[model samples]
Target: MSQLTHRVGVALWGIPLLVIVVLIGGGLFALFLAVVCCLAANEFYRLSESSGAAVSIGIVCAGLLPLVMHFRPDWSLYFLALGILVIALTLPSHRLENLLGRFSSAAGGIVYPSLLLSFLVLIRDGAWEKHYYGGMVLIYILTAIWICDTAAYFGGRAFGKRKLAPVVSPNKTWEGAIFGIIGALFWAVIAGQVLKPVLTVPQCVIGALIVGTVGQLGDLAESALKRSAGVKDTGNILGPHGGVLDRFDSLAAVAPVFFFYFKALGMV
Candidate 1:
């Protein structure tokens, strides 16, 4: 099946890169990944209708992703403000049949993805070290997402009886969601035990829970965006898996939040 082949192909492409980042280092690696984020953001905006809200390229630019990667907490504040400002500016002073909700819709599409994804760069620079565990954290976050998603898939297939969100993602079920949480927590617990020297168990558990939940929510959020834009997937760059953006959607939101917690504890 294409699905099985797709999974295998993705892992083949992804796992080697994961090893490189984790073992070699995460500093320059993280910097190099900025393009991925930018393209992802751009594609998200491109998918929106002309009648959508105004996409604020300037807003995302003003907040300079690289600057945030340097680990300035202040950058996030500016980024947030810029998002709001763009959104506000995009609002129509007057609504009419003649005037569509172009500004508001595009604003939402752009602001939504950028605001969450910018945190990835922030966290990439802020995690444990600029180099060592930063890569590991990135891999770890995605691995956690994978674990959650994998468990959800199997669990749902075997015991899915209740709908989770039929409108947004019809395939997701309550059973799948619950099992996904358990799987995420289980991975976090194991990582906590093994990686305690770098990170504590309690922190691992809590961070995993927070990241996994938010990551799933981020996926759903992106799904909503796609649906609103009248698209099935974001792109087809990665064969059956869609684009890198589709793959990283969940992890993007997780990176910054988890990185902040680590920073607060002086891990970064």
Candidate 2:
């Protein structure tokens, strides 16, 4: 009935299913991520359309190309190059500005929703290779991000004074952002204690900092995109929460950061 009600209802069903998919960690998870990225890419294209830069709908298939890189992450460059070439070829326009606009939008769609989200698959698959706690790592990341966001929202509502990014997201405040970071650290400490097989307390704290800061920036980046496009919410697919891109913006931003962190530590 209410927006909060819708949010909770979706999470109630969605979280469990997400846990299952991440834990499964293979083709099933890859297929699931492919669908989400495609939908998010479609919404991003719609946003670009609203900004007067229309990309070819056919290029939405470019979302699937990233999952192809799940097994061979090095192929990302090739896939991106091919996507750019295809976009340049497919989107024919008379004005040079129009062509550039379309090309930029198409390329952005490939990177944001497609290439960025693919790291989630890589995170799960790579981590799963070494330990059973791999899925738990993903779950920890998601949970920390969610907690950070939730704390930010509520904390902002209660004690928000200074604007964090008034131009992009007017409601967000520095107070809320600090609260978000604290929430993330809180969860990381708890997870570190339990996920001893994969992470140390120090690693978890570092992860909290990365996910907290990067993930919030991702949210702001998405908000900036929506603002520039002159719209609220990328799409209404997620009811009160907006769309797939709206929901997963933070995760998309954090996935690569965490993935690389694990890689650097020789964990994934």
Regions more than 4 Å wrong, model 1: 1-3, 22-27, 50-64, 71-110, 127-131
Worst 10 residues of 2 by lDDT: 50-59
The candidate maximizing TM-score is 2
Give all TM-scores, in the order shown. Answer: 0.79, 0.92
Clashes of each: 8, 0
Query: Which lDDT tens digits does candidate 2 get at residues 1-268?
Result: 8888998998899889999988877777778887888888889888888233335443454556656766567887787777677766766743566666667787788788777788877777774446447788989998999899999999999999999999999999999999999999999899999988788888999999987799999999999999999999999988888999999999999888988999899877
Give the runs in model 2 whose Cα sits over 4 Å from its true position. 50-59, 72-74, 93-97, 127-131
Provide the lDDT at 146 for model 2.
Answer: 89
Please report, as a residue range, the 10-residue window in candidate 1 with the lowest summed lDDT: 50-59
List model 1 lDDT by residue over 95-174, tens digit each: 44434455555455444455555555555555453355665666677778889888888999999999888898888898
